[model samples]
Structure formats: C-alpha cells, structure tokens
Target: MGEMRAAVLFLWIQCTSGWMHPKCQIYDSGEDLGHFLKWTCNYLPRHAEHYTAACEDVTAIEEDLLGLPPNINTFCISMANGQNRSMSLGFFSQFQDLEYLYIDGCFTQILPTGNIHLPNLQHMYLIVKWGMGSGCCNCHIGPHTFRNLVNLCDLTIQGYRLTAMAPDVFHGMTQLQRFIISEPCVEDLSEILCRIMNIKSLIELKIKAPEIQTLNQSNCSILNTKESMKPVFNNLASADFSFGEIPHIEEGALAWLQNLTGLSGAFSQEVLLRLPLSGIQQIQYFSCSGSNEIDIERICNVVFLLSIKKIHLANANMRSLSMSSVELCTGLEYMYLGGLGSIHPSPHLKWNFITSLKNLNRLNIDFLRDKNPEICSFQKQPITWLTKLTLLINIQILFAKQFSCLVTLQYLDLTQNLISNIEDFAFMGLTNLESLDITQNKITQINANTFFGLHSLTWLDLRNNPLIHNIEAMSFTHLTSLKQVFLGQVNNPLTEPVIKLNLTLIFGGILSQLTHLYISSAMRPKGYMGQRVQAG
Candidate 1:
C-alpha cells in the first residue's frame, strides 16, 4: 500500500514539474478538443507527444506556449481569426529540438523581429489569410526576421496580402533548396529575382503572379549578366513564369541560365521570335499558351532549330497549320494541341500532316468541330502514314472507313462530341485497339453490329449516355477479350425514374471473361439479385 502511494505521488510531481506525463504530454486547445483527444487515444496513442494549440481572441502568445515538452519536434499553431492575431519574437524559445513548424491563417502586419534562432529547424510554412477582411493591413517580412534559421531548407509563404519582402529577407538561408511564393506580396519581379540569385543551390522555382505584365530587360537583366561571370542559378533545371500578358523577352535575357531544360508560359509570337534561339534549342520540353494567332512559320522555325521531344500548345489558333510546316518537326514524339476554337481542318490537310509525323507516337487535339462527310472523301486515298501512331484523342469522328488506316492504334478517346450512333464496322480496322471511351455523348442505343470488329478491346466506357432501356445482346458479343464495362447513370429527365436493365439478358455470354462491371442503382429494377448473375 505504501509503494502504491509513492508511485502515485511521483506521477503527480512529474505532471506539475514540467516532466510531461505520457498521458498529459500532448495538449490540444480548440473547439473540438474533446473529440480530438478521444480519437487520438483510440487510434493514434503513439503520436500523443505532438502538440497543437488553437489561438482565439488572444493578444499575446508567450504565456500560452510556455513550458512545452523539451523533445517536441513538430509544433502547429492555427488562429481561428487570423486577422486579429499576430506572432511575436522569442515565441518559440522553449522548443529547442523543433524541426517542423506550420503556422496557418495567422500573423498580420509583421512577423517576429529579433535575434531569433532555430538551430534544428528544417521546414517552415506560413500561410496568412489577411485578404478575408476588409481594409486590413498587409503582412510584411521584416529585416533580420529569418536571419538565424541557418539550417532551414524549404520555406513557403502563401498570402494575397503579403506586400513587401526585404531584399535580404532570405540572406542567411544558404541551405534553402525549394522556395515557393504564390501570388507573392512583392511589387517588383526584379526584387524577387535579385534575392533568388543569391541562393545557388535552388533547383525548382515557381512564381504564380497573375497581375504582372511583361518580363523584359529590367526585371530579367540579372540573368543576362552575372557579377562573378558565373551562372546565376547554376542548377536551375525547371522554371515556370505564369505571369499574365508576358509580351516581351529581351534577347540574351535568359542566356546565363545555361542548365535550364524546361520552360512553360504563354508567350507571344513576337516574343518567341526574339528569344535566344541557341539557348532555347537546348530545352527538351516546352509548353506555350497564348491568345495571339499562331505564326506557323515562326513556330516551324523553332521546331526545326530545337531538339524538343514534347510540345504542348493551348488557346493558340491552328487554322493556318499546313503539312509542310508540321513536317519540319519530325523529331517530336508527343504533341498536345487544345482550345483551337471552331476551326476544322480539311480532310487532306489533316491526313497530310498526321501521316507526315513519322516519329510521332501520341497525339491529342481538342475543340475541333464535328468531322463533316466532306472530310471523309479522302477515304479513296490510302493513309499508310499513321503506322507508328498508337494513341489518338479528341480527333474527328471515328468512322471505320476513315480511320481504318491506323492499324497500329491502341487507345482512342472520342468523348465530348455530337456522336449519336456507332454505325456498323465503326472500328473495323482497329484490331489492336485496347481501350475506347464513348462517354458523355448522345448515343441512344447499341445495335448488334455496333462493335463488330474491336477484337482486342479490353475496356469499354458508355457512361453518362442516354442509352435505350433495351440493348441488343450481341452488341458486345464480339468483344471476347472485354474485361470491364461502365454503364452507370443513363441520362434521364429529372422528373422520371431511371429505367432498370436486365444484366443477364443484355450481357448474355459476354460476361464469361468479364472481371468488373459498374452500373448505377437506377439501372437496376426492384427485387433484382446482383449475386445471381455472378453465380451463373
């Protein structure tokens, strides 16, 4: 009895003496504290050493964060109303072994200012939500604020109201590798680049500023000329400049970035022409989006000069694309062209360019109008050019007579179109086709010979179509290799209940090799036995 009393007394002393009793170690102060504790005790008892505190109507932070566990490595503090709260200096003095700190939706006006030191800290994320309130002050990164975080490697600051960052804000962070600023609060791009040039080890940098317009010599001159005659970002391999309305890229501006391999942005034809041709030729991947009419001549010139393997163009007018122009980039393997508007290429123009791409393997083109019967007149001419093509997406109608040339095609997507019927032998020559998606269309019924020739087809999707209640059983009988079928949510008027389907009769013996089937409840009638079909 005496020993039991002594043990109990010892535990009580530890709890009050800042030794952190195992049960009372992790402290959570929030509106859902009771529920959080119950869940932690039941499922995550091993992680009870972590501490999280919710800030509410608090003017000071030192009093609430004092006397924490000495071994605490991760600390999370979130403000219920970030606009009303702020952080002060020396607030993290107790957590000496802290490595990761996350401050979400907090800190307004300014961060802590002092000889703040976090010896072991490696990753920090500060998200300030100052834009939610009206007439609120912007957050500022004061000088010497992050001076003592010598070991910090990754830092992310995301806030709409961040207005200014001192030139030397990241001065002492020599070990920083990845820095991301979403809609940065800074006003000048030059200021950001000047500071980023100091970090030599950074490999990936992303700046998403929608308000900025034009990246010219003023902001990008640092990359053109280096102080020590060395590359500014010696290791920068990938850079994204998603600024709005970037009209100009001065010549020799990006020359110093010798190791850059991938660049993505919406650039104008004039800006593209002015780019350092030699430097850009070294890039292996390029993605460009713009509203200006695509200059086929200049684009072809770039393709001929560069050894790029993949090219993606969005919102560019391809009305002027010609066979001769496309034939210049024979080295390209993957091409994705989208948002082409209502322009439809003639049958000869489409066939000529596609057949000319001898090295092309995957092609994706969207937003083109329906394939007119006039375009199918080229069926008389044999198209033995697409022998190497494997995948085609968002192209015109897939009439078997017109597409029989692509004997090696494996995957085809004909979704989001005005396709109402799949005429007999629509995919007759595609013996190697593996997957086909005809979803989100106006298809009403599947006739017996609708899919007569897809011998190697393994997966078929007919979801979100207005399929008739009664389907011909032999419609899919030819697909002996079929493995999965999706027939969920047949399009029906809101006022009417979904029409049920008889699975055993519709699928017949086609389910012999089927492994997976998806159908909605609306497609099943009352008193239906799903297990009986599997048993048979």
Candidate 2:
C-alpha cells in the first residue's frame, strides 16, 4: 500500500509539472514550466484550434508540426539563427489545406528537388539570408522546384544570390500573375525576361536593379524579334526599369509591347529619338530624366509624338521652354517642372503658355535653391488666367483679390518660401479650397480677414512657423467646413517656451465641427472653459 501511494504522488507531480501530450494542439518549446502550466490549465480546456511553437532549433519542431489539426491553413516558422539551414523535402506535404506559409530568415542555398505537393496553397514567401562566404556563389535553382504548387498565384523569392536557374524552373506555374525581383545580384536582364515571357497572364513587372548600367539592343533582342515558338509580353501593362545609369534602349526594342502603358527610366535624347514613335502611341504615362544634356528641344520633339498626358522632368534645362514649344504637346493634364533654379521665365510668356494648357488640372513649379532667392521672382505680381487648374505650388505670394480668377483651385502647397506677412483677403477667391499646406514658412500672425473666402476648406496645416503670439478671434471664422487642423510645433521651442492658445476664442463656433486637432503638450492652456477637444 505504501508503494501504491508513492506511484499516485508521482502521477500527480507529472500532471502539475507542465508536461502535456503533443496532441494538445498548442506546443510552445520556448515556454518555461510555470507559464506552460498556466496556459495548459487556463487555455487548453477550451480546445484551442490554432497552434504555435517557438524553438531554438527549428529541426526539432518538425515532427510537432504534423501533430497539428488538419484544418490549419496558416503556418509561420521563424529561425533563431539563420546561418546554414535546409528545409526537408515534403516537409509540408501533410498540410494540404494550408493557404499561407511564411518562412523568414532561413539560410538555404538551394531548394530541395522533390514533389512537395501543396494543392491548395495560394501564397508563399521565402526570405533567406545568404551567408558571407564563397559557398554563396554556388547558389542556383533546380528544375521542378515548385511543380506541385498549381494554385499558387503570388510567389516572391528575395535575398538570394542566385547564379543560374534551369530553363524549366518556372515551367508549371501557369496561373502566376505578379512576380517582383528586388535588389537581386543578377546582371543580365534579357536572360531573365526570356525565361519569364512564357507567363501570358502577367500584367505588371518591376525590377529595381541598382548595379545595372545599360539595357541596349544586344541585351534586349528577345523583345524586338518575333518568335513563333516563344510567347511575347502581350498582357504587360506597366513596366519600371530603375537602373543606375541611363539605359540605351535601341530602336524597335519595345515596339512589340503594345499594351505597355507606363514606362519609367532615364534615357538620352538620341536614344529616345531612335525609338519607333508610331508603335508607342498608346503609352500615356512617361517619366524620363536626362543623363547627358538637358535638351528642351529634343524633349519637345519626343513628347510631340507619343501624346503624353503626364510628364515629370528632373534636373532639366528649361531655358528653351517657350510658348510655341510647349504647345506641341497639347494633351498634357499634369506637369511637374522641378530643379529649375536657373531658368527664369518671363512673366508674360509664362502666363501665356500656362493659359494655353486648357486641360491642365495640376501644375507644380519649384524654385527653392541654396542661394539667397534670385532665380524666380513673383513677390507682388498679379496672378490671373488659371480657371481649370486645381493645384499650384511655390509660384509666389497670394495677394488680396489677385487670385479671383482661379475659382477651381482646391489644393495649394506653398511650403518653404519667403512670405512673412499675409494681408487681409489674401485668399479672397479660393472658395472651393479644401486642403492647404503652408508649413515651413515665415508667416508671423493671422488677422480676422486672412482666410476670408475659404468656405469649403476642411483640412489646414499651419505648423512649423513663427505664429506663436498673435491669432485674432475671427482668423478662421470663414472656415466653417474645417474638420481637421494641425497646429503642433508652431513656435520655435529653442528660442521660447510653448505658446498657450485660447481655444474658445480661436475656433469659436467652428470648434463644434472639428473632428481632429493636434497641439503641443506644453501649449495646453490652464482653466480653459470650452468643449473637450478630440485628438487625432
């Protein structure tokens, strides 16, 4: 009887010491005795469906994964040390219903070659860290690596030093749509495109290669010639080629890609002129920066053919920008002419060219330089003739009753300028202005009629300024439709303490409609008698 009693005590200790069967559906190898016992006692009785395991050695938890419920659809494994690890073939073959599998920070040189059938898996991301050694140069892909994943739509293979891939590496992925290769060590662009052109359903392709210099005809002849045996990229809609230097694309290089709507890269004028203009008439979005010389005449000659709608020129020499030259491309709706600290347009000629763009919806002209502001000057000029435009930036100051013709202006950004004072009725005709950003300026105070006619304004950003002391009671009275206001960091704290604002007198009746308000902690007033403000 004494021996029997000792056996019962041993069984009691085993049950209380946090040792449960693997079939309990929640296995945490990293948990200590106390925490494991608490979880088993509190959470295990409800029959938790999900299972999670954290192991110092990932290989030891491979058997425990098979004991999970068969209906488990999501599985994630994170390795503690990712120096040299290998995933076993057919390791995940049991969980056929799994839909998502994410393996992060696992160092694998090559994927195992075997039929690891996952018929229902839809998404998979394998992010491995290639070790710093000579063994990384031997990394490659074997055939039939992902042969069983028939339903997989998105596949991303990143952080690998792949030297070569077999011809049939992606042979079975017929339904794949999007493939992204970012920051890879691959050199040849034509070799990669030749392998993936068989994917007929691909719509978007983006390659961010920082090491590549040129993409001339020799490397891109696959797209130029028509092959009856191989398929072309007929369904490709958008392509972004962001190499370091200006890639020299030869004539008829991208002529067969009829559905390509957007193309972004830096190219020279001579190379751009060599392209088949009649073949790329459907391309509406083009963003090209000059690498050799900023020839405005060459830019006009190229833009006149494709009928571009939106163009962004960076580091461009706009000295030849004239009314007759800009009128060639009459279909432009949005234009961003930046890095123009040296090209100053005459006020009369600039106004004529701007008014001629009848369909223009947005225009951004930046002239902020390192020197003391002598490039573009419009300190006290009469602003007129922009009835259809909706957005403007960094043109000049907005005097009272000067912008009465710009009735359609809704969004305006005049940040980082040399405007110190805004006279009364400065924004007199901007009745439909919804959002305005005037931060990083030298404006000191606000008067009663500063924003007199902005009735439809909802969002206002007035931070990072010297408006610390004076703000009249009716300064924002006309902005009854204001919903959000950002007034944080309005004073230079290095020179003075935070300024206290009278919320009752500043917002008045408009405070009831404000849904979001941002203010500094030190600027909160004491003994304030107003409604409780909502913080956004």
Score every model by TM-score.
0.72, 0.72
- Top lDDT: which candidate number? 1
lDDT of each: 0.59, 0.56
Tens digit of lDDT per residue, candidate 1, span 70-173?
65665554444545445764567567766776655555545643676778777776755444543323566665567677777877776634445555556656
What global local distance difference test value does model 1 have? 0.59
Candidate 1's clash total is 1
Question: What TM-score does structure 1 among the candidates reach?
Answer: 0.72
lDDT of 2 by residue, 277-387 (tens): 425555566666654444556665666677777777664555555556677656777776654344543222233455556667776655533212121132233234232
Could you tell me the lDDT of residue 318 within candidate 2?
53
